[model samples]
Target: MPKIQKRKIIIAKLIVILILLTIFAFSCDSKKPSSRGIRISETKTYEASLYRQNCAVCHGAEAYGKEVDGKQVPSLRFGEIEKKTDQEIYEQIAFGKNLMPSFKGQLTDEDIWRLVRFIRRDLQGKQQ
Candidate 1:
């Protein structure tokens, strides 16, 4: 093969390799866990939005429940939530209790699960 033709082929191979490497890097990054241990692609943005819109009023924006009258509304943070199992939390979210409303028809199972995850992992900082 001519020297110039060989050089061109080598350059084309290098370009292909570089492109593949770039794609591999990005693909790996997409699977990386965020500081909260959730995948970068699986961020709690949607769940957080759901919490803000649905539960934040009673639970407070930070998952710390607000008081009504002279009673404490209860906080979803660490110590307060540590008493309940994930299943219990799921049931509560699905069924509702007292002033809290049921999210069964409004939110899907997956959405509720995501909220549970956000509350447990992100808000309460529980390790899985």
Candidate 2:
């Protein structure tokens, strides 16, 4: 076929492959808890507002976890996140891990630290 047609076909295949990979990558076990504690909208704290803007999408507004189309996004409030150190949480926010995107450039160090505190203090109800 023509070069233009061949290029289009290649692009289409690549797009399909990317989509499939994304779906597979994000897919999680269905047995995990669907929803539990607080709803994101209920919390009125500044930290909660920040979380609503940045993390509520994947983690759900309440941090109780979220599942979309069989894909399970882990909850900050329920998982081993509580076991993690403040530094660990801070690093995860600064530098993304697995499917979580990094917020290095998007948020300042202070903001990221605040988020860490928000998760620990506000969401988890643990004093630092």
Candidate 3:
């Protein structure tokens, strides 16, 4: 190979390495765990917004379930969440209960999980 070509190839490789290193460092640096120790930054924000928009109306805006369609959905604030597994809550939300419609199509798994965490955190034991 020509000397200049070799130099160019080496430079390109160096640039790629630098980029990868920067990405790794940035990710590792910001990866400290949150209060729940989940090590996820979006969990809190995404969950809060999701709850506000999708759950607030029927859940009393605090995950304290409200009377809707003549049926009362149970409260969801704090330790009340401890009673159900994340999967269980996910199922209920995604599939819906009676008059409620499923949200599986409207939301992604990540968004649902974030909302689950929020339910467990903010309203689980708030009124109890």
Candidate 4:
């Protein structure tokens, strides 16, 4: 084949590789800053909306914790919980810790992660 054909093939392969890496990175359970940057989308007003629909009931409208069934869930709106490691938070969400129920069946991993992101960056310490 001609030199141009080889270059085109190489470029196509590179594009495909990048796309695959993006998918893999997000799907990875161990994603970290070095491995994969968790992208908090600029279009996250929708995410805050989701939080209201799904999490606000228990975590409170502002994620400042809520009382359900006489149990008080901690405020996820910042404070210590806001800065906890993702693994710790994920584990709590996956397996009901204390009064908070596990959201494993109710939400997809992405949805849970988005809620986490909203609490961490938006609601947490944010002045509305």
Candidate 5:
């Protein structure tokens, strides 16, 4: 091959390789930082919005609890919540307890379960 033609082919190959490398680097960059990492799934995001709109008023923003009608609403972050099984939490939310009102008709069973999971996992930091 002519020297100039040979040089042109080499440069083209190098450019192609660089382009591939750039693509690979960007593909591997998908991992987010650990601190900012955990993405709330669509379900969890919906559940969170549900909690905030419906439950957060009494449970407080973080389920830290708030007062209602001279009564102190219990915090889901506390020891009592930890002791409660998922079923119990689900029932409480569905049927209501103390000042808490029933959500049975308003919220579906699945949504109640989502809230239970949110409380246990997100608020209480429990794995399950």
Candidate 6:
């Protein structure tokens, strides 16, 4: 083959490889693990947003808890949160206690459940 033709063939092969690589990259599942190290599902995504809007104020952005006044606000990071079952946590969120306010009317059952999952799986890193 002529020098020009060889150069053209090499360039074409390079272009083909680039195209295949781009397709593979795009085709690969984009569902990445979140900053919390949990794989974010649709429900989890919504739950995370809810947590930020509703719960983050007292719970801290990472659900690690914050101190208010002279008292330490309870953290959802670990310990007690991990010990509680899904239903128990749901009740706490729905009914409220002490400083925490009830979310009974504000959040639906599904939203609460997703919140529980997010707290357990994402914040606490507990396996469901």
Model 4 residue 98 lDDT? 69
Which candidate, 2 or 4, has the higher TM-score? 2
Cα-based lDDT for every prediction = 0.77, 0.81, 0.68, 0.68, 0.77, 0.79
* Residue ranges of candidate 3 with Cα displaced over 4 Å: 1-44, 78-81, 125-128
Most lDDT-accurate candidate: 2
**Candidate 2: C-alpha lDDT:** 0.81
TM-score of each model, paired residue for residue: 0.61, 0.65, 0.54, 0.55, 0.64, 0.63
User: What digit string (tens of lDDT, one per residue) describes model 4 on residues 62-105?
Assistant: 56677888887777754678567777877787677766688899
Model 1: per-residue Cα lDDT over 53-109, one tens digit each = 778777766666788666677877745577988888898999998767799999999
* RMSD, every candidate, angstroms: 10.9, 15.8, 14.3, 15.5, 10.0, 7.9
Candidate 2: 10-residue stretch with minimal lDDT? 29-38
Q: List, residue by residue over 11-128, the lDDT tens digit for candidate 6.
A: 9999999999988986785664444534333434777898888887787766667887766777787657767888999999999987778999999988988888888877777788
Model 5, poorest ten-residue lDDT window? 33-42
The C-alpha stretches of model 6 lying farther than 4 A from their native spots are 1-44
Model 5 global lDDT (CA atoms, 0 to 1) = 0.77
**Which segments of model 4 are wrong by more than 4 Å?**
1-44, 125-128
Instruction: Supply candidate 4's per-residue lDDT for 96.
Output: 72
For candidate 5, lDDT tens digit of each residue in 1-128? 89999999999999999999999997778454222212232235877888877887887766677888788888877668778888989989999887689999999999999888877776666787
Query: What's the count of clashing pairs in each model shown?
Result: 0, 2, 6, 0, 0, 0
What TM-score does prediction 1 earn? 0.61
Best model number under TM-score: 2
- The TM-score obtained by model 2 is 0.65
lDDT of 2 by residue, 12-103 (tens): 99999999998877676454443443455766777778798889898886687799557888879858898899999999989999778899
